[model samples]
Target: MILTTHILSGAALGANIPNPYAVAGLSIVLHFLQDTLPHGDYLNKKSRLREFWKVAVDLAIGLSLVTAIVFYKNWLSDEVFLTNISTGIFFSLFPDFTTFLYRYLNMKFLRPIKDFHEGLHCYENGSRRREFRIENGFWDIFITLASLLFLLFLCAG
Candidate 1:
């Protein structure tokens, strides 16, 4: 899924979960679960440079959207709200960030994580793997918007 969708979904979970530790744990689990679903990703199989630019843009937009939400909701003033939401956002994005490091930095320690992530992906067959595609980009946008709106309603009430 796109980072924006992940962030909004994680933030929604964070807002309702209440417990920081649980929210963090669940956010990580949710990341993998969401990946299994049909969702869009901008990463290209042909060009690493293009993938990097796409990811950079996506992350920048996702972070900006989250920041705007935080300010609009005034969540920073509430310690519990701040902790849960931030933890959720971080943990949800952690898997992908780690995967990037493993791919580029060749981190041996992250091999297990990388393997598990690959296994969780939808296109992971016995010997063949598929690149993530933007065919589902519309779904990503719909889900992100719906999750954000729901979170906003929850916060307001």
Candidate 2:
């Protein structure tokens, strides 16, 4: 997601103020990372609420920066790519659609592959990075390549 946001951050350098792609990418990265990072399940209501608000505020600021850029720079001018409402909507929707598809594929296909591999691996000592066989590496690489191809196809259309 940082990678995706990095692409849009380039927009700011392109004489635009806030970039929708950057905003969405940053929001998704922060939200997903915060949600996934292991933290104590036990927390007071105030602490949990504060944590939630902190992430929320970060997201809002990113989105606001995007809006500020668009309006302040008159990014809808012919010089900007997103010059229409539809284009604006498309930029806003792009990351969410990609994320949904990625998550769907991970749940449907990747999880099964990981589960099968997990069944074969055992650790006498606690260690997370286990080098699997060449076949496993190929499977992982194939999935990523296929995903990239799919994205390219989507962009082409």
Candidate 3:
């Protein structure tokens, strides 16, 4: 499945299908890839990325709620905001929610997936793909290229 978090789907976003549904669908795939990537983040028993992501997510959500209260002046009437959030999460899981479930299951029933993520900033992948499987910026480059193409297509259309 080329569209399965492979980055090329980001390129296809440029095709400009004109149907908001299609664009929305593609965005779902993009977000899934983004969420699945532990690039700027990773998870392990003693995972720094996991810790950071937890704090970041908590802070962001808290800040966003405060901002919403300040901006809207009526948090009680924020049903639309809630709806949009539900939609966002719903759309975000387009490609591989099952994989997430599988990971949970792995940790629940089986053993923790090893070869745990690493901290490889400003360092090379050691002359081998396997060495860098956890920290290869090349994947992000491919994804960026695809996203760029998709944005271009949107502009063209």
Candidate 4:
């Protein structure tokens, strides 16, 4: 799943769940759950620079989309709202961020977590084994739209 979808889903979970600890724990779980689903990732292991640029662009757009949604829903005005949503977003992206660090910095302590994350990925074998096609961007839009709609429902409720 795209980071944007994770962020939105985490935010929705946070909004619905009042307990901070539960939100944090469930956000991380949701991150892994989403990754286990068929999704498209644009990262390429052969080209470091190209992969970096692609990931940078994806993160930028994802953050922008989250910010827009927060502002649109008037979530910025409430302190509790800010805390929960930010916490959710942080935990949701924490796995991916740590995996990136482990890959580049070769952190021994993070190796376990990285290995666990890779183990849960649906595309672990490669895109050929992936049920979804990256070329068409179908899963990307499908997941994003579904997440956005769910977020809206959570916010409205």
* lDDT tens digits by residue: candidate 4, 1-157: 6677777777777777778899999999989987786666665333364458767776787778778888788777777877887788888888988877877766879989988888887666355654335663565677677767776654653
How accurate locally, in lDDT, is each candidate?
A: 0.76, 0.36, 0.39, 0.74
lDDT of 3: 0.39
Best by lDDT: 1
Error of 3 at 27 (Å): 4.4
* TM-score, per-candidate, Cα-based: 0.84, 0.28, 0.32, 0.84
Q: Which stretches of candidate 4 lie over 4 Å from their true place?
A: 44-50, 130-139
Ranking by lDDT: 1, 4, 3, 2
When 1 and 2 are scored with TM-score, the better candidate is: 1
Every model: Cα RMSD to truth: 3.1, 13.8, 10.0, 2.5
Model 2 Cα displacement at 75 (Å)? 1.2
What is the per-residue lDDT of model 3 for residues 12-63, given as tens digits with 9 covering 90 to 100?
3423344445555766655544544433323323333345555455335533
TM-score of 3: 0.32
Tens-digit lDDT track of model 2 for 37-142: 2222111212333454543553455455555545654555644444332233334334434433334444454545334322343321123232323432443344
lDDT score, residue 135, model 3? 54
Model 2 clash tally? Answer: 3
Clash pairs for candidate 3: 14-150
After superposing candidate 3, which stretches have Cα over 4 Å from the reference?
1-27, 33-38, 44-82, 93-97, 107-157
What tens digits encode model 1's per-residue C-alpha lDDT throughout 1-157?
7787788888888888888899989999989998887554556333465458777787788778878888887777888787788888889898988888887776879999988987776663332233344555556777788887887775652
